[model samples]
Target: MEIIGYARVSTREQNLDLQLDALKEAGCKLIFEEKVSGVKDRPELDKALSYLREGDTFVIWKLDRLGRSLKDLVYIVDCLQKRKIAFKSIVDGIDTNSALGRCQFGIFASLAEYEREIIVERTRAGLQAAKERGKLTGRPIGLSEDAKRKAIAAKRLYENRDYSIDEICRILHIGSKATLYRYLRYEKVRLMNRRNK
Candidate 1:
């Protein structure tokens, strides 16, 4: 049986040396390496999974390294078994060629599913609580006070007829039409207050 190893890291900054070394010691004939976020596209992983044939063994350093999500791990293992490919994890000491390994996987898969359900429940509860408190959770507004000030100054310059809008924007280093519109809104608010007074 051909032994193929797969090693993955979540970012370009992480080293694959340790996993690669372990796979090599485990006698893998070929090792596939990928530096990608596990939550997203995993083309290399998909290819490795597809390449498995009957009697072929897929090896990895650890189960967690294969995937962070339990569902994904279970799916991959299930596919390998369906194709009659053996699966092994060096650190977890799991070998699909044995009866005990199958039992262990069943238990681990159940626990993983339970953990995911709990995570979903907790996240929904937290979001509901935050909604009750009128708290917004997402990307914060990017404009800082200094940036807003520069936009306001640019608007004021144009309003006072001190400088053309283009010239003021050039001086303030704001190049986008959307940003100019924001400034215009700020100016309109001030203009309305002045008129009221």
Candidate 2:
């Protein structure tokens, strides 16, 4: 049976060298490495899971490296068990093929779910308190007040026919003509509606 290893780090700046070396020393025939946050989707991890087969072993350097939530980790282990594939976490000393390991996994999973629920509850309470205080929880993304002003300036410059679209982009530090056009389209709609009124 082949041994497949997976390793992950939360950020792109983080290194996977240590986990790679450990997995290699552990006799991993193939290893998948991903540089992304646990909350983000991992294409490499999906590929590794897809490559698994009966009698093959799945390995990881740590439990958290395998998945963000304990529930997700447990689900992965359960799938492996159903497939007759073994699972191991080198750092955590967890092996799903053993009785003791299975018991420990259940306990760990339950505690993790409990902790997650507590965090969710506290976050909701905090958001409610902030709302009561008339504070926004977070700022909106994309074009803001400053961007709208710049977009309006770009439209005015464009209508003057003195500068090309490219020149307008350069002047405003806009990324592309396409993005500027999107903003222009919105403004065009707003202008049309005002005239219709």
Candidate 3:
């Protein structure tokens, strides 16, 4: 079985010697190191995970070095378990090969789930409060005055038939044929409303 190590520092200015030395002392045959924020994508971390095989031990100097949050950490560890690869964190004293370590990870998984549920509950409560207050939520209903003027102009240009749909959009600085069509529809509805009145 191979023992592989992964080390990371948040910034290029930070030294990785501490983590690297710890991993080397722990007998990691192959080590991958990266200098990147935990919240950002780490190509070296991805490479290290891809390099790990069944019966391999994925070692890290500290738990935070592996993931940005508890949820992310649990997900990575869960994937490792499914792949039959062991995980070890030297400073955190976590070893997936041990029963206590597995139990600790299980607690982390549960806490992550609880946190997600709480967020959903709070969001629902907020939406309900807004509804009770009769405040409009989400996108506004009508176009601005500038858009209405554009719609009127688009309709006039369309009725004249002097310009192609592409030319009309270009003349009006509209982004797409779809946006031009929407403007045309809006003007048609406004005209119909006026005729009814």
Candidate 4:
């Protein structure tokens, strides 16, 4: 069985020496290193994953070196497991070859799920409280200020009867006749509201 290693640093200013040295000490036969942010594409990581084979172990200095978040870590580990490739994180003491290591990974996945659920629950509760207080709990119901301005101009042009619908749309920078009609409807409603008030 072979031990393959992958190391990464978020920027060129950071050194991969520590992770590289640790992977070498761990007897990694092939090591891939890169300096890239976790949020960006990691070509070296893709290469390392492709190089791993069944009965091989993929090693990293730490779990964070392999993935940007717990969900990402779980996904990579899951893929490795499906390919019969073991995983090891030196600093994190994670080794998927043993039962305890497997359990630890499972706990990480569970924690990720639990965290997501808690966030959703808290958001729902907060929205409900806002509604109870008679506050707007969602998106505002009206055209934006810029759209309202365009709607007013379109309405005035339409009432002048000198410009065709298409001409008015072109003059007002509106996209379509349908849009111009919608804007005209908005202006009509606004004027009706003002009259009633």
- Please list the C-alpha lDDT of all candidates, in the order they appear: 0.82, 0.83, 0.87, 0.87
Off by over 4 Å in 3: 162-166, 189-197
Ranking by lDDT: 3, 4, 2, 1
- Least accurate stretch of 10 residues (summed lDDT) in model 4? 188-197
Error of 2 at 12 (Å): 2.2
Q: Which stretches of candidate 4 lie over 4 Å from their true place?
A: 152-197
Tell me which of candidates 1 and 3 scores higher on lDDT.
3
Scored against the true structure, residue 179 in model 2 reaches a CA lDDT of 77
- Scanning candidate 3 in windows of ten residues, the lowest lDDT window is 188-197
Per-residue lDDT of 1-197 in model 3, one digit per residue for the tens? 99999999998788999999999999998999888655668899999999999999999999888888878888999999999999999998889899998898888899989988999999999999999999878988777888898888989987776777788788899899778778888877332222111
Candidate 3, overall lDDT? 0.87
* lDDT per residue as tens, model 4, 1-197: 89999999998788998989999999998999878655769999999999999999999999888888887889899999999999999999999999999999999989888888999999999999999999996667889999999998888877776777778888888998777778888888332212111
Write one digit per residue (lDDT tens) for candidate 1, span 12-83.
888999999999999998988878655678888888887878999999999988876788889889889889
TM-score of each: 0.58, 0.57, 0.85, 0.77
Model 2 per-residue lDDT at 95: 85
Candidate 2 ranges with C-alpha deviation above 4 Å: 112-197
lDDT (C-alpha) at residue 84 in model 3: 97
For candidate 2, give the lDDT: 0.83
The 10-residue segment of model 2 with minimum total lDDT is: 188-197
